[model samples]
Target: MTAVDFEGFVERLATVAGEAVMPFFRTMIGVEDKGGLGKFDPVTAADRAGESAMRQLIKSTFPGHGIVGEEFGSENESAEYVWVLDPIDGTRGFITGLPTWGTLIGLLKGGVPVYGTMSQPFTKERFFGDGGSARCRGPHGERKLRTRACARLEDATLSSTSPRLFSGGDLVAFEALEDRTRHTRFGGDCYAYCMLAAGQIDLVVEVGLKPYDIVALIPVIEGAGGVITDWEGGPAAAGGRVIAAGDRRIHAAAMDLLRSAGA
Candidate 1:
């Protein structure tokens, strides 16, 4: 099936995943430490439940398609068409009862991202895109997504999940970039990227993200006429030390600073 043919399926995946997760939101769901000792990576029952529901539906509806999920490992991952899922892209925010978290559903064809959706069920919002175009539907009503122009670093508003996620050379690089931006706000996980796509934010710099963490965001950003790439200006699908900007000029400027800091 073509990418367009899968759009309906993608929405269904988001719906069921949301159903599985919403019940746990703001409830006393148990949180487990997936990160050992020095770190605090957390996983909750909701994360597992949402992923499981999506996985089951995908397996049943499109038996040949592959799936790579955060809560569960890959299955038939080398197939021609694959689904990448981060059931709750912001587990930290979810645990804190924050609505900033969302479910990320991305589709890859021949190993390249073709379509993606970020669904915030709590707020009844969905942002989706193919590489060429993007749109959002929410309480504000449905509208096309477009990144705002801010060609210079000094005029850009930047965001990251947390500065704490960066350390050593990465931290240094991020801080240098932060200093140049008009404003830097922390704590938005997947929501930050969607906001960037919606023209509300200008730049987003993040490090140490997995495929599931970023794959769903690629189409949304690119479709909105923004640019997303790695520290050295390579494709960001692999997701290490990534930077995205509403304007290419800002993207280039950010890359220069990151490279200078030896990121």
Candidate 2:
């Protein structure tokens, strides 16, 4: 299979994401349940419309490519190259007027993420990674990005999507993490990984994610010089658990915590 143009694709996708999300930033709109884990967390018109826009852009610009989106199902799945889009990764945060939500776009070559971009329109911040390099773009032009050097879990800061979702082994692992980390915070979706990439947060442990949620994040986090994998150190493919850290030392420690708790 032939590889896609990572740089060009990121620019185009960023433009589409920015354009599609800005209008609905803080506007008054009704929210409805798409029924995943519950009713409080769901998609909105903005999510559907944004994914549609990205899919259209890909179809028109790269008709031979495939797509896997959160709102819509897969298309042209047999193509050599595929795009995974989560138009709005943080639906609850967006609906609640929190600026932590973001638009995620990822390109997988033969089912492996090779390039990706995450955009936060309200904050005017963008992070991108592909082919081993990652950078962030803001009002000051582009800046090189990297994870921090926090050497241990005890020394690191931690964040999770929510504590309520963890059950059985997941809940036990999370509790251990809380006891180990220097600090812990909550309420960030895919943006938590972005913060880790920027070195703002050191560790992000989460579960109940699809490929579209974590694939776009892999290159972004690792390219920024971090480590991301499932709790068992497997790749965070769709529908798998994820434990992303800004440094390898912390990653190993976090994994130890999960395994210790029988996760």
Candidate 3:
């Protein structure tokens, strides 16, 4: 696909996802638990339906592209282009009527994200990056995005989906970064990364994320002058342990803490 074609499609896909998610926003929707035995992870009709909508569009518009989604399994995962999806990224916020929840749409070229967007359907905001640049569109109008400059961890603001999402030594590792930061907040999921890319937050440290959860965020964060990588300074494509910083220096500082925590 040409560059323009793919970029335009990213926006189109976000719109499609937003349309799907709006139907179940605050209504009485059924939710099922998808966590380990008795753990209360949630999957709502919005999540399933949002993904189904995006998948149908992908299948019809780009029949050759692959799909890796949270609610559904992968399809043609080896294709040159794969659309990774997390229909409702922060299901907790979604079910609770919080606006931080968003639909994540990531386009991978040869297994690496070349484009991504986080669409908060309820708030009508879509933040996206097309490998080289990032921007946001919604009620506030469209504007270019750029990561803020923070050279030290001590001067940075930190965020994570939740402290509860991490456990054991991983929790300890995250706390090291947290304790060193200027301020700490929790629970934004994909939305937090969008904020970081838009020069709002500084660093985001998250662990145990799946490919669908993070793949779409990489391009958005990076294209906005930010850096996203695994704690050990590797490609974050596979998405197990992830750290994103608006500034490279802060990333390095946070990585030192994360790496030492694991040691």
Candidate 4:
């Protein structure tokens, strides 16, 4: 029922997420497929361990806060505060030794994202954002972040989890999307939104996602002067479809393709 002191919580959770995921990033680990439509979707010990670390921190630091994590189910739902977490956002990429994966942490007040941080241990990229400002932390220290001014889709670069992650009717819109953007690349999880927030990518589109998957990215994108919503221009929380673009024009263009696919 009350707003969280995001500045304090974001820093605490970012540290926990970064620490929990670091050891796993350095060591080799086995992977397993948690049932998706196909057999290739992967899950690793890091996913479970990292999320468990975050859950423990939330419970200890804010006992009244609710938590919704990818590896674990919801906890303390009656609480007014919600922490949405994806301990490892790109598990498929993570298992493959790809450094695009990152940890996502979002603090939501009554279902609205108000604070978030996406931290990539392998790449040493950290992004944290709240109502007032957003920034990235690296070897050079923190710097204010901003989305690009790319107003047209043709002038924009596109990125996503993977084009192959889409199937059937979903493939139609994805193909059309590539045709519109100046360039397209695969492999970015919550990090894609971080890139958008940092003005690195123009647009990020994903066909299927859960609330945990997109919630954390909302504040980071919006705080950095970008727009993120479902393809229909509705709330991203209500729908699995997510379109994050540096500018409104690029978002609209990507949405056009998504709409055409009936997404």
- Minimum summed lDDT over a 10-residue window in model 2 is located at 1-10
Ranking by lDDT: 1, 3, 2, 4
- Minimal lDDT window, size 10, model 1: 254-263
Identify the candidate with maximal TM-score: 1
Residues 174-199, candidate 4: write the lDDT tens digits. 88888878998788787778888999
How many clashes (backbone atoms < 3 Å, residues ≥3 apart in a chain or on different chains) does model 2 have?
Answer: 1
- In order, candidate lDDTs are 0.93, 0.85, 0.89, 0.82
Ranked by TM-score, the better of candidates 1 and 3 is 1
Please, what are the lDDT tens digits per residue for candidate 1 over residues 7-75?
Answer: 899999999999999999998889999899779999999999999999999999999999999999899
Model 4 ranges with Cα > 4 A deviation: 1-4, 261-263
| Candidate 2 Cα deviation (angstroms), residue 110 | 0.9
Candidate of highest lDDT: 1
Provide the global lDDT of candidate 2 against the true structure: 0.85
What TM-score would each prediction reach against the true structure?
A: 0.98, 0.94, 0.97, 0.92
CA-RMSD of model 3: 1.1
Model 3: runs farther than 4 Å from truth?
A: none
